[model samples]
Target: MGAAAYALWGSFPLYFSALAPAGSVEVLVHRVLWSLLLCAVLLAALRGLGDLRALLADRTRTGWLGLAAVTIAANWGVYIYGVQSGNVIEASLGYFVNPLVTVLLGVLLLRERLRPAQWAAVGVGVVAVGVITVDYGRVPWIALVLALTFGSYGLAKNRVGRGTPALVSLTGETLLLAPFALAALVVLEVAGEGTFTSAGPVHTALLVSTGVATTVPLLLFGAAARRVPLTTIGLLQYLTPVLQLLCGVLLLGEEMPPTRWVGFALVWLALVVLTTDTLRAARRRAALARSAVASAHG
Candidate 1:
């Protein structure tokens, strides 16, 4: 299930690319409104309407979900633009950088302390960004924006707390954003710029299917989370970016000059360091728990 979720996520470039002539903004608006519609239907089908109502009744959680909506919308918009503009490789780098960005957010927002290994990993990530920036002859703003918005989205979700079901939280977030998305779509249609009606039946269907495409992987990931360890999920998370990178290079035929290769190598090195530290930490915690249990039994 985890692999399927990431695999779907990684293949998004191909999906978004197929939505051409629609533009990123139009696609994003459709994604938001249609996703909301799908979430509503799923909530009704799964008997989760009560959960959604309870989530909406809470002001604090609602505010966090609203923020999550904004950040994730931004992430989706930037990602769409990147893929449509033939920057799939750069966009893939964003997900590669996202874990590090989350760690940085923890330090800055939550006042968490990082171990030495984590600090080293972050340092390597910074250098990697610098190398990639130089190679691109400008800041990889698309990648940076994608990483930051997603990191912020994660922070908002953390605030909403894990006790909330993923579907319920997504419904709340999309519900908050749906009005704005609807208004934007109306404006686009009025301006005769919307593709939903003008585009052929195939294109129209693909646009609508965006909702299903967005929701399915999320549901799969949620299901996987219920039955997997965090460490396992963490390892599985990399599959998405790795597949995306392959899609960009092999399928899209994006160029990766030597400098860009070096930058990506550094990023992978940092991920290795971070992953090793994470695994070691988890093992240590497990050992300590076992020791405590043994002591109690003895």
Candidate 2:
């Protein structure tokens, strides 16, 4: 399930590519509409309406989701634009950097502590960014924007409490955004610029399919995270960026300079360090738990 989730996300360039003639904004609006409908059905089937209602009723919690919706939508828009503009490599860089961004947000916003190794990993990530910047002669703003927005989304979800059901929260998020989304769609239709109207049957279907493409992986990733350990899920999360990087390089034939490769290598090295730290932490906890039980028996 985790692999499936990452794979779907990694191959998003293909899906988004098929949604041609519609600007990223139009496609994103359609995604919100369709994903809401699908999530609404799933919420109903799972009897999650009560959860949804409670989330909506709690002003504080609802505020977090509202905040998250902004970041998620921004992340989606930037990502779609990146893919459409032949910047998939830069887009992949965003996901590759996202885990580090999340950790940084934890430290900065949540007042959390990090291990020395984790700190080293972050330092390396910064160096990687420097290397890439020097190579490109400009800051990779698209990747940075994507990472920051998604990281903010993660922080907002964390603030909302982990107990919130994924489908329920997402459905409610769509509900919150639905008014603006519907308004945009209506405006586009009136102007005859909407993809659903101008893009023809196949493209229209592809645009609609973005909803399922967006939601299913999220549902699967949530389920997998629940059933799996953080260490395992952390490792699995790398698959998305790895696959995306491949798509950008191999499938799209994007030019990758030697310096760009070096930067990516440094980033990958940082991830390896972080993943090792997570595994070590998890194993240490497990061993301590076992020793406690043994001591009790002894």
Candidate 3:
């Protein structure tokens, strides 16, 4: 399920690509509004309305959840903008570096100790970022922003616990942003600035599909995250960024310089180290459990 969700998410570039002229901001607005409506209906259908009420009653938790939702929305908006505007390679860089960002966060925020190999991987990432900066003649801000925002979003989510059902919680989040989305739609329409009307049928369908496009995979992802082990999901996360990178280079005709290549290489190295560590830990735990069971049997 995680793989499927990530696959769908990875393929989002195709959907957003067709919506040119509608612009990223416009599409983001629609995504927020439509996603709210869709998730709300689904929640009601699933008899999850009680969960929404429960979430609302806990104002403190709801406030924190709202912050998380907003953070994630910012991450989504930036990512969509990057993809639609032919910056997909940069966007993919974000996800590639995400694991490293999480590691940094752990070190700084959680006071976790890293092994020497982990520190070496982080150093490699720093060098890669320097290479990318030199190649671009500017900091890789978009990629960094995507990474930081998303990393923070994940951290915030951990704090929130199971405050509400996914649908219910996300519904509240969407509704929080709906008014802004509605205003943006109105402003864009009034200014005759939207890409919807001029782009014809295909673009229009894709634009509207952003809502389903956004929500469906998330639902699938939420389901998948629960069913799959963290290690499996951790490995599968790469699929989305890989697809995005391909779309940027092949489909969008974006050029990747040698320095950018080095950056990506370093990021991938960090992920390999992290994922390898996680899998080994899981294996060690399993082996220990087996040994204990064998001793008991003996």
> Which of the numbered candidates is closest to the native, going by highest lDDT?
1
Clashing pairs in 1: none
Task: Supply candidate 2's per-residue lDDT for 168.
Answer: 89
Point out the worst 10-residue segment of candidate 1 by lDDT: 165-174
- Best by TM-score, which number? 1
lDDT (C-alpha) at residue 39 in model 3: 88
Give per-residue CA lDDT, model 3, range 182-257, as digits (tens).
9999999899898777778887777777779888888888898788787888888999999989988888899998
Would you list the C-alpha lDDT of every candidate in the order shown?
Answer: 0.94, 0.91, 0.83
Candidate 2, 149-208: lDDT as tens digits: 999998899877798888988998888988999999899888888869566888878887
- Per-structure clash totals for the candidates: 0, 0, 0
| Model 1 Cα lDDT, one tens digit per residue, 1-298 | 9889999999999999999889999999999888889999999999999999988888998889899999999999999999999999999999999999999999999999999999999999999999999999999999999999999999999988888988888888888888999999999999999999787999999999988998999999999999999899999999988988998999999999999999999999999999999999999999999999999999
Model 3 local distance difference test score: 0.83
> TM-scores, in order shown?
0.99, 0.96, 0.92
Residue 138 displacement in candidate 3 (angstroms): 1.0
TM-score of 3: 0.92
